[model samples]
Target: MSIVKEFKHVNYLWEDSVAAKLAGDEVALLIYRSNLLGADLRLTNYGGGNTSCKTIEKDPITGGKTEVMWIKGSGGDIGTLKRSGLAGLYVDRLRSLENVYKGIEQEDEMVELFNHCIFDLKSKAPSIDTPLHGFLPFKHIDHLHPDAAISIAAAKDGRKITQELFKGTIGWVDWQKPGFDLGLQLKQCLAENPGIRGIMLGSHGLFTWGDTAYDCYINSLEIIEASAEYLDQNYGKKGPVFGGQHIESLDANGRKRQAAAIAPVLRGFCSSERHMIGHFTDDARVLEFINSKDLDRLAPMGTSCPDHFLRTKISPLVLELEANANLADIDDLKEKLTPAFEAYRHMYKAYYDNCKHENSPAIRDSNPVVVLYPGVGMFTFSKDKQTARVAAEFYTNAINVMKGAEAVSEYTSLPRQEAFDIEYWLLEEAKLSRQPKPKPLSGRIALITGSAGGIGKATAKRFIDEGGVVVINDNDSNRLESARTEFNTQFGKDAFAAVLLDVTDSEKIVNAYNEAALAFGGVDIIVNCAGLSISKPIEDHTEKDWDILYDVLVKGQFLVTQKGLEVMRKQALGGDVINIVSKNALVSGPNNAGYGSAKAAQLHLSRLNAAELGGDGIRVNVVNPDAVISDSKIWESGWAEGRAKAYGVTVAELPAYYAKRTLLNKIILPDDIANACFVLVGGLLNKSTGNVLNVDGGVAMAFVR
Candidate 1:
């Protein structure tokens, strides 16, 4: 039952070879072992665990050897840990400050002392659990909130049961907010129980240590494996099955469609003044937990551990759908679910009022981070997709822990006061407080058409960089896929979604909007950037060329804008729409009848939408850009050379020729146009609508009055 010995992927010899070359071999080994532990989701979720190694580092300046503990730094996850992610603190200095803890009445001051003990001033702040690692005599330590361990740790009489299962190989500590006091308690417990190899903190997690990283890691694996084995022998088959006659009628895709249909409504209801993006998951386990009969009794008990409180509020919102309600009718579902969310908010306010201390920060927005719908699985919501995903992961793990514990006896979590204390603890809050200020459109979602390259791509990147989630759309599948990969790589995998479709097709446009809604709850801004250019004299222009230009330029803008308006209305949040028209709309030119007329009409359509949607708080605007032909697809389709020939310049000199003609004498880049889009959509021009912001490098002929 030793999982580490049985793990076939890890090569101890290779790890030793790599660690042998490092000056701080213990630190190097710690990093390698931390990564291995992080690779398994069963061992850690996101950045939930910490690891440390005690070693002696000779001071470069003083040439004196000093004991040091290199622990995983705050905000660093072991999965991506590097040398920089581990903070090196002088253990002697930290132990010397033990007297300082007596006078430290506030937890924040103790945290300050922890930072003060760092040997390298430039190193990241040490993990808050540094004292625990430093006080232990072991050379290596690993602490994780593994699901299997928590199943035993969160059970009723958990300490007694864990003692029975481990047979005194592990010591138990009562749940305490992780701080100087808890660290001292752990050190005292280990001193009293000299033979214990590991310790389980009731209602929290486990800590294992040994003289070597391999020993510590293997001990953790064995402890976890033993916990799993115990649970399997005692309660594996006692839990209720997930699906029965209730969900048998619907197939997998049908259930997914139901979840997709209801996610936006749930998002809208859960969101406060600012919108929240919903991440939907119906993984078999999630479905089982949501569909379980004991959901009402078990779901409200709170997070399995205090670490999850910040991400997924103390408890999830459990909603029971009407037995005969229609899932396909979104409006009807919204009507039925609105009161449940309102009641959840009311209950949360009451809980905060009763449990919060006077020094506690103001109550957070009362919207639930996790929502449980009987037949529709679960929906986790947050300001962005990444946090939502993390919440969903932790909640899924919580379900496993709860089912295992329930099967044994009854699952018990930390009391509500303890959960609230950790949630609002100043030390815990300080971790997030260190983040930089958010951008203007931090929580907003935008859908930009033609985002594969040029102005559309630039605009999408700008939105993402400024803390907005964007759904990139384009008719070019290859380019769209490439752009998606590039954006996801630069930002995060959850930052962007790509939909390949023609904006001119009404049916496809509607489906694309639906796809965007499902991906990021709903759209907050819409950028109509899909278009082409055709240069032909009025007499030479054929009907086919005119139709093609009109369909893509004007009709495309109309269809996309209309669909965006519908989504915005459903969300009941004010939105912005930026139509990427051309300078030809403001100023006419010969041999530009097809392109110019269509753009001019598109500009008019924006004005009409602005007029109609003003009362709904939807701002409609147009960005008129010119001479951005260098990387645009329109130029690659033969329009660039033809336009250069008409202007009496070579294709290479076309950009300069247009630049010199403008009053500013500057080459207008796609990024410049993207900046204008940001200003209009990012609330800088909140009070203005039905207006055209020109990014044409100050074209005198195209200046609007």
Candidate 2:
């Protein structure tokens, strides 16, 4: 039967008018189709699937039309693919590899041969699935890892179900590692099952094809949607999901408290091999799976889809806790966490010993990429925030697969040997080796106060450039949002998050750190730059002036840094705290009593924190920036006039006066201060703490003795 286009859940998105506009452009239609398919995680996930199209194009040298294939390239996600992200290969040349094709053992060699088939000099490197796409006879193809299809593919009677779902229209192929051999098997399956619309690769994914891009898209949707409908109709027929909930979940607020408490602790343990950035999700589905009885039995079986485990790892570490355990009791959790992580690492080492081939990349980080907690949620960690987030998403997909597969039939994961082969595949290792060396702060998370402008914003940018994820906390909502947008654009949306917060508000400070916990796992660096000045003589300073100055500069810095320390202590990961004190803290001048005294308090606070936090591996240092007149909101707020008056110069001459008085004849700017913050936390001062770095143009009076 032809496609039964009943999209009760996954909708039909192909617009006839849009497809008509791109009728003659095969590659454009393919990309459009790929984007549509990828837009919904229910259909396919980030970087999970590959789409391909073949077209007749003019040969650059021959001046004749030639058949060329355009396929989503390695490291490219179908949803965000661009022209440059597609690899263009001469179809005839790609097919010529078959003449010299060897067996499955030589499959890794075929990927190198694909480079020789490139028809466009600028084409991106082809993905490992290139041969699978090239070998197919169809002009357009989609290989998607939709949960619905994979549910049936992972079902115990998967082959039998595939035959039942499409009858003879969709053929079935047995499992084999992805490569030249599997590509040939796909071609053979289609040839044998003549006129089949698609084929189901056992324990793999769905494959659909058509003569045109539009037809190919519709074909993929029909198969996936039908599989979804089948699962929906059949779910609950067998029994309750995951053998029903084994434990009831804590209330919403309680769950967050527990998750926040557990996040850094888990992150610390997981970072044993290397520092890991973290992402957490209490997504209802995730909670359901973790709270279920089958979690213990099933999670160890691992994910059925290769794409899922490639990010989530072969399996997840399921946190075992007593039913109705005290969610707020972190000490109890810590006791359990230590032995649990030790057991997990031991399990992983043994897994490697059992399955590793001689050429396998010497055992990778044995730490789990994914962790499942009952009554709380899921936490995923990786080398960067994006990877960590994507891993969480993919594992949630795995959860859905497990749900559907169990509802229909017993869920099955790839055999351990097979999973090991793919996970430690030579190709995957090559990809890892080719990855760029990590930036200094690759997985570091920073929480910067007053980050909406001036030194804070510049420091946030510097940390982001060095691969740190930042939380921009400032009381100015407008400027905070503007800075957030600017950094999001310059660096990527995942680079930073913004919180409009009053630092002195202890409650808000707590919430901001919790937000940081959820946004990037834990804090690795803290920058206390929030300050305001009440620059008046002691006699002119009213009680209110002293209170406001101390509230902002002294108390606010204390609260923000204290909260940051809480997270850093939980992470148990050595962190850096850079306090943006000022030169006035050391060098007293007229009309600077209140502001200067507050800066002095801020400076001393750093020392106090440094002394106490040393054993915890958190280094506290001070950066004193003087004459940072440009772009400073504090400077704009009457402090410039007060400082200029005290220095015996006009506001405009303040810069020149400060520059001339300096031993180095330089005026400090926000970026210069940012550089000092970066230097202290950027691994250079790992061995130093309680020290103050002066960013002011060398002033003898301000020099720390």
Which candidate has the top score in TM-score?
Answer: 2
- Candidate lDDT scores, in order, read 0.81, 0.87
Error of 1 at 414 (Å): 1.5
TM-scores for all predictions: 0.94, 0.96
Tell me the deviation in Å of residue 532 in model 2: 0.6
lDDT of each residue in 1-705, candidate 2, tens digit only: 233365776867777778788878889989899988889899889999899999889999899999999999998999988888999999889889999888777878889999999998999989989989998878999999999999988989888888887887888888788888888899899889889998888878988999988788888887888899999999778888899988888888877877777788889899987888889888999988999888889899998889998999888998876534664555666787889899988998898999988888898898999998888888999999899999999999999999988988889999999999999999999988888999988889999899899898889999999888999978988888788778878988778878888987999999888888887788888899888876776788889888999998889888888888777767778888888998889987899888888899989988999999999888889998888877888976778888777777888898899899999999788899988888897776689999999988898999899
What TM-score would you give candidate 1 relative to the actual structure? 0.94
Candidate 1: what lDDT?
A: 0.81
RMSD of each: 2.8, 2.1
Model 1, residue 407: C-alpha shift (Å): 2.2
Writing each residue's lDDT as its tens digit, candidate 1 over 1-705 gives: 212255332222225455456535788889988988888878878888899998888976689998888999988898779999989888988887777776436655777888778887768887778887888878999989888888888888688888899899899998887877778878999998998999998878999998877788888788888887777677546535422224422456665666655666777777765678878777777777777666777778887687676788978998777423576665776787788888988988888888988788878789899987766677899978888888999998888788668767678877888888888786777776888877787878899999889999999999988889998978988998889888878987898888987987988887787777667777889999998887766787889999999999888888888877777877777889999999999887767888888989999999999999999899999999998975688987767776877787899999889999998999998899899999997766899999998999889889888
lDDT for model 2: 0.87
